[model samples]
Target: MDYDVVIVGASIGGCTAAILYGRAGLRVALLEKHRNIGTAKRLCGHFLLGRAQAPLQRLGLWDDMVATGAGTGDLSIRTEYGWTDRSRVDAPPFLNVRRTTLDPILRGRAAASGVDLLLGRTVTGQLTEGRRVTGVRARLLDGTEETHTGRLVVGADGYRSKVASLAGVPERFTPNGRAFFYTYYRNVRHTLPTPAVVWWNDRDWVVLGPTDGGLTEVAVMPAKDTLPPDLTDHAAYIERYVASLPDAPDLTRAERAAKVVIAPDYPLIRRHPVPAPGLALIGDAALTADPTPAPGCTWALLSGQWLADATAPALLAGDDPAAALRRYRRAHRAIEREHAFMRGDAEAGPPSAVQRLLREAAVHDPEVSRRLALVGMQVAPTTSLLNPALAARALLVRHRSRRRSAGRAGHAPAV
Candidate 1:
C-alpha cells in the first residue's frame, strides 16, 4: 500500500511528524533503523523549555509526559557568581525527563495516532526521478529489500542523514568545536537552589538537572581538547572554581552518580530550502546546532508540526507535492534564521567582561536577572546584548564597582 508520507528515522522528529500527519488522516510509515522502537540515546541533557510545550499540548502528550514521572518546573541558570530562576510565564512549564523514558512514550503515542511502525528497517537509499523524490529503498532485519512509495518522503534522520544525501540536497555543516560529557546518578544531592543549573567558569561549563527517581543528570561542556581524559577531572575543576566565587555552594558532598558520557556539541546549521519538489527533511536532518540554545525536544516538536502543517493541505488537494514541499522549505528557513542569530557567539570564550558586569547587576536587580535568564535561554535576541543603551549601562555599573573598590584601597584599581 502506498503511503501519503514515509518518514525515515523514528526519533522525536520522525515520530512527531508521523503523529501529526497520521492524525490529519494521512497514512504514514515511520521507519526506525534500530531493532527496538523503545530505545533512546544515552547522552541527552533531558531538559525541555517552553517552546516544546506547544507540540506536546497539541498532540495530547502533555498529561502523558507528566504521568510518566517527568519533573515539571521552571529552569534556572547559574553563572560564576549567581543564579537566575524563572518560572513558566504564559508557556508550559519546562520538563525534566530521561530520554529513555520520553522517547518510548512518544513512539507509542505516534503509533496510536495511526503511524505504521517499521522497526529494524534500514533505509538504504532514495528513489528519485530527476529532481523529484518518489520513494525509498529499505532493507529489513530479515535481509529482505523492499520499496515503499510515498507522495512525500520526510527525512527525520539525524546528523548523518542518508536521505538528504540521496536527494542531492546541499549539505549543511555545523562547527563541532566543543564536546559534551554527561552521566546520570542515583541518590544524588540537589543542594543547588534549582533542579536545573548552568555553572560557567572562566573556560568551562556544566549543566546539571534532576531526572526521574532521584537521579541527577550532570552534563559537562568543554572545548573538545580541553577536558581531561576522564571528564570527571572537570568535576574537581568546577569545585575549585566555584569555591572562589562569593556565596557558591559546596558540591563536594554530593556523591558522583554515574560514569561520565561524552559527545560533541556542534554549531547550528540549516539547509536554506529543506524540502524540494517531492522530498522533505525535518528535525536534525533538516537543521541542527549546538545544544547551548537547548535544541533537543523543542526543535523536534516544532519541525515535526511544521512539516505536518505545510504538507497536509497539499496532500488533501490531491498530491500537490511540489507546492507543499516549497511551503515546508520556506517555513524551515524562517525559523532557522531566527535561531541562528540568537544562539550567540559560541565561538567566543566563556562570558565576556561586559556580560559578567551585567550578570553582577542582575544579582541585585530582578528585572536584570530575568533578562539575563532570557539571554541564557536564547529566548531573547543577540541584539539585546549589543544594544547601545544596555551596553552603556553595563559599562557604567562595572566602572562604578571598580571605583568603589579602588577608593577602599586609597588608590585607583589597576586595569
Candidate 2:
C-alpha cells in the first residue's frame, strides 16, 4: 500500500482526517479534484458554529483562522412572531470565515502535517480485492493516470459522492421540499450583532452572516411551491426577497460581492452502508441533511475527527482495521441519525403545535432558550429538549400564556 489511508476529497472532512492520520505517523494521500485546494465552494454560507471551535483549536488552526479575519458573534433566530435571543449560552460565538480563507488554512495545515496533498486529480475508480477496497485510480489535470494504493479508502466527498456510488453503498434520500439561493454583499449593515441571523417568515427561511474579507452572506430557502418563475434570475429574486424582510438590510446600499448561486433543491441523503471492508465514508458522503440549519460544516469537521480518533490506534498498530472502522460507523450513525431526525422533522412540514409551543416558550424562558441554543449549536443532543423536567415546564408556560390571553379577552380559560 502506498499510504495508510487515501481520502477522496479535500474539503473540511477529508483534510481534517488527513492531517490527523499524518500526525499519527501514517502515510496519507489527500486527493482533490480541483486544481487549487483553496478554491471557495460556490454555494456555502461558510459559518462555523461554536461546536467547531474545539476541533479548530486542536488542529492548531484556530488562531490562524482568527488572524485571517474570522469574526465571532452570537446567533439570533427570528420568526414571524419574534426573535429568540440565545446569546446567553456559555458557548463561544460562531466563527464566520469565508471558505476562500478557511480552506487554504486547513489545506496548509494538512500539508504541514506530512499529508501528500494531491490537487488537480480526480478519482476515476476504486481499487478493490474481493470485497475490500484497496486504493484508487486517479487522473490528473494533464490526463496522467496514477494509482495510489492504501490500507483504507475514505470518501469525504460531497452529497454526490462518486466513491459512495463506486463502493456500492446503499443510500436513501428525502426531498427537503425547498431550494436555496444566496449571494454576498459588501458594506451592508445588519440589524443584529450576531455572526449569523436566521429569519423564519411564513415558512420561508433566510440567513445572513458576516464572513471574512468584509463580506456578508445572505442566503434564502423558499418553499418549493412558492418558488419564483424566474429562477435563473437569482440576483433579482434575491434582491426582492431580502428587501421584503421586515428589518433586513437594504441590499441596494451595498455592492454585490459575488454572483448569486442557487442550489435548486436540498434532499436529505443518508448513505446506509457507511462502512465496509477497508472502506469508510465521512461528511456529505455519509449523510446530508437540510442546509437550512447550517449544520453541514460542523458535522463535517466532527465526523472527520471522530473517524480519525476511532481508526488511528488500529491503523498504527497494524491490527484488524475493520474493528476500528466498525466503531466509526456506529458512532457516526448515532450522532448523524439524531441530527437527521431533527432536521427532517423541521423540514418535513410546518412546525407542529408542540414545536410552536416550545419556540414560544423559549422566548420567555431562559433555560428553554439555552437548551434550544445548545441543540442549534450541535453541542447538545436533540433529546435534551424533551427531558421530562423541561417538557413539564414548557407545558406549564404554554398553559399560563393561554390563560393570560383569555383573561385579557374577558373570557374563561378552557379546561
Candidate 3:
C-alpha cells in the first residue's frame, strides 16, 4: 500500500480526516481535484451549528477559525409564532465563515500534520484486491494518469462523489422538497448584532447569515412547486421574496457580494451500504441533506473526526478495521438518520402536530425555548424534543398561553 489511508476530495471532511490520520502517525494522502486548493463550495452559507463546538474544540479548529474573522453567535429563529429569545438560549454559538476563506485554514492544518496533499487529481477508478477497494486511479491536470494504492480508501467527495461510484457505494436519494437560492448581500445592517436569523414564512424559509467580510447571506428555501414561470429572473424574484419576509433586509439597496445561485432542490442521501471492505465514506459522500438547516459543513467535519477517531488506533495496532468502521457507521446513522427523519417530517408539508406543539411551546416556555434552540442549532438531537416530559411541558405551555390570550381577548377595550 502506498499509504495507510487515501482520502479523496479535500474539503472539510477529507482534510480533517487526513490531519487526524497523519497526527496519529499514519501515512495519509489527501487528494482534491481543484488545482487552486482554496476553492470553496457554492451551495450553502457553510455555517457550523452548535454541534460543531465539541468537534472543533477537540480538533482545536474553532479558535483559528474564529481568528480568521469567522462569525460566531447563537442562532435566532423566528417562526410565524415569534422569535426565539436569544438571551434565554445559552447554547454554544454557531460558526459562520466563508468557505473561500475557511478552506485554506483547513488545508494548512492538514499539511502541517504531515499529510501528503495531492492537488488536481481526479479519481477515475478504484483498485481492488478480490472484492475490497484497495486504491484509486487518477488523471492529472496534464492528462497524465497515476495509480495510488492504500490499505483503505475514503470517499469524502461532495454530493456527486465519483469515489463512491467507483467503490460501488449505491446511493438512496430523496428530493429536498424545496427550491433553494442564496447570495451574499453587502450593507445588510440588521437590527441585531451579527445575528444568524432564520425566518420561516408561510411557504418559504429564509435565513440571514452574517459572515466574514461584513456580508450577510440571505438564503431562501421555498416549496419546489411554487416557483414562478420565469425562474430565469432569479434576482428579481429573490428580491421580491426578501421584501416579503418579516422585517426583511433592504436587498434593493444592498449590493450582492456574490452571485445568485439557485438549485431546484438537493437530494437527501444517507449512504446505505457504505463502510464496504477496505473502504469508507465521509461528508456528503456518506450522507447529504438540503441546505434548509445547513448541516453540511458541520456533519462533514464531525464525520471526518469520527472516522479518524474510530479507525486510527486500529490501523496502527494492525487489527481488522471493521470493528472501528462499524462504530463510525453506527454513530453516523444514529444522528444523521434521526435528523433526516425530522427534516422529512417537516418538508412533507406544514409543521406536524408535534412540531406545532414544540414551536408553540418554544414561544411560551423559556426552558422549551432553550431546548428548541438547542435542537435548531444542532446542539441537541431532534429526538430530544420527542421526550414525553418535554412534550407535555410544551403542551401545557401552549395550553396556558392560549387560555391567557383568550382571557385577554374577552376583556379587550372596544375599538
TM-score of each: 0.86, 0.93, 0.94
lDDT for model 2, please. Answer: 0.82
Candidate 1 to truth, TM:
0.86
Q: What's model 3's overall lDDT?
A: 0.81
Cα RMSD, model 1: 3.4
RMSD of each: 3.4, 2.2, 2.6
Write the candidate numbers in order of decreasing TM-score: 3, 2, 1
- Candidate 2: RMSD to truth: 2.2
The positional error of residue 30 in candidate 1, measured at the CA in angstroms, is 0.8
In candidate 1, how many Å is residue 174 off?
3.5
After superposition, the stretches of candidate 2 with alpha carbons farther than 4 Å from their true spots are: 85-87, 346-348, 402-415
Error of 2 at 63 (Å): 1.9
lDDT of each: 0.71, 0.82, 0.81
Residue pairs in clash, model 2? none
The better candidate by TM-score, 2 or 3, is 3
